[model samples]
Target: MSKDSETPEERRERLRQEEWKDNLGGNLNDSLNRGNNGSLVDLVGGLGWKGTGILIIVIVLGFIVYSVFFR
Candidate 1:
């Protein structure tokens, strides 16, 4: 449609709709990134502490058992 044929109110509404769509897309992206980052931090933190503790405990127990039996 020609710009001259479109009413001012229609033009304004169209522009507003475009702006709303753009903002919505941006907000969705931001929310997804935030959630992903939070999940990554939680995963890393959980593994860092729990994994290390379990590993250390297993290693120490293994060493003790080996020394007692094999020595």
Candidate 2:
């Protein structure tokens, strides 16, 4: 069957498998080692440098916009 015809449950399962496959580098249970000793930086290690940079920029810009316009 085509992906368009997939049920919601089937679609979710397919996406979940794809994400784990891509995220875990071939294995499912292997997780990132954030050796920052359980600090907030550990969150960034999971996301890596690029993702952390983008996230920080987005958050800072969003906060600035919100403070300027919404507050």
Candidate 3:
């Protein structure tokens, strides 16, 4: 089929292949098997103090706003 006659799905599949690579940069299997991969220290410390603080403040503000406006 000619380029102009290509279906929408064919064009999308071609572009998606170009945009997204199937290759993994490193060994995902080895990383997941590590014991501490999903620990609480990893979870909390990943956010750092500043990020955690800001997230708490934002959630508090959201709750306040919801209470005032919606309830």
Which residue pairs overlap in candidate 2's backbone?
Answer: none
TM-score of each: 0.34, 0.40, 0.41
The regions of model 1 sitting more than 4 angstroms off are 1-46
Summarize candidate 3's per-residue lDDT along 16-37 as a digit string, tens digits: 4564455444335434654646
> Cα-based RMSD of the predictions, in order?
19.1, 10.5, 13.5
How well does model 1 score by local distance difference test?
Answer: 0.73
Q: Which stretches of candidate 3 lie over 4 Å from their true place?
A: 1-41
TM-score, cand. 1: 0.34
Which of the two, 1 or 2, has more lDDT? 1
> How far off is model 2, as Cα RMSD?
10.5
Q: How does candidate 2 score on lDDT?
A: 0.70
Q: Model 2, poorest ten-residue lDDT window?
A: 27-36
lDDT of 1 by residue, 1-71 (tens): 98789976577667766876779977677669878676543454457767868877998999999999999
Which pairs of residues clash in candidate 3, taking residues 3 or more apart in a chain or in different chains? none
Each model's lDDT comes to 0.73, 0.70, 0.66
